[model samples]
Target: MAESFLFSIAESLIAKLASHAFQEASRLVGLYDNLRDLTKTLSLVKAVLLDAQQKQEHNHQLREWLTQLKTVFSDAEDLLDEFECQTLRKKVVKAHGSTKDKQDPGVLSIEDVGVCF
Candidate 1:
């Protein structure tokens, strides 16, 4: 059960790493090379998962390793999600400009009309 779950997470992480937004975000943050390395590592891990699954039942150490791996994969997925969100947020800010840079067009201050209290 743990093996299959870990395998799925590895696959999901790989797919996220390959996404265009994630790539662009990673490159902007100077993580492109690191992410590339990670992708390669994930592919290798994925390949090993099938074998590991078959053998884990007979090996206690392997089962422990898979559990640890599952935690790492979960962390990686969360990191990717955060990265993607930041990327999208930046895109939105670029498109709409910062809130600090914008003012409510319909609202006016009394000073603008030189009103006396």
Candidate 2:
């Protein structure tokens, strides 16, 4: 039960982060880079779930491992949430026409932002 719950949370987080838009606009600002890295790490975590689930129940240490993983997962999710919030902040700033100049491609256009990605 613990193993399944952990992996499912991991899977959901991965899917959430993976679904973000990393197009040319976001690429210029570097959100794409961070997103890519996090996605890769999450993908690796997802890949290991099968093996982890199989072993977690049998090994006493696996419960501790799960605890550690849960901590990491929580941290990663928080980071992603911060990243997303930053992105939205930028979009909001840009959409409000605060400092959206052509020279500042760092701010993704409102059109570029689709579903917080």
Candidate 3:
């Protein structure tokens, strides 16, 4: 049961990363180059998830390894979510600029409107 649960989570993470929104987010956040690497790593993790789960019940070492993998997967998911949030925050800030950024008498502050990344 535990193995299947983790397997499902890995599968869902892979599905989420494959979407257009995630691709766009990756591009926006400068992870475009690493996206393929991430996919490959996830594929490996997914491939091992079931096997580890099945063996864990009888093997102590495999069970410990799967626990570690679960932590890694959770952290990876959080990082991906952070990048996507940053992308969305950028879009929102660009779309609706601050009053100061939009106008300041006659001069627009380049610093205010500039995106660091």
Which candidate has the highest lDDT of all?
A: 1
lDDT of 1 at 45: 96
Q: Is candidate 1 or candidate 3 better by TM-score?
A: 1
lDDT, residue 94, candidate 2: 74
Would you list the C-alpha lDDT of every candidate in the order shown?
0.83, 0.70, 0.74
* Candidate 2 segments exceeding 4 Å error: 22-26, 31-34, 97-117
* TM-scores vs. true structure, each candidate: 0.81, 0.64, 0.72
* Candidate 1 clashes between residue pairs 3 or more apart in a chain or in different chains: none
Query: How would you encode candidate 1's per-residue C-alpha lDDT over 11-94 as one tens digit per residue?
Result: 999999999987887788898999999999999999899899889989999988998999999998887787676677678679
lDDT of 3 by residue, 51-87 (tens): 7765777898888777777787788777767666666
Span of 10 residues, lowest total lDDT, candidate 1: 108-117
Among these predictions, the greatest TM-score belongs to 1
2 against 3, candidate with superior lDDT: 3
TM-score, cand. 3 = 0.72
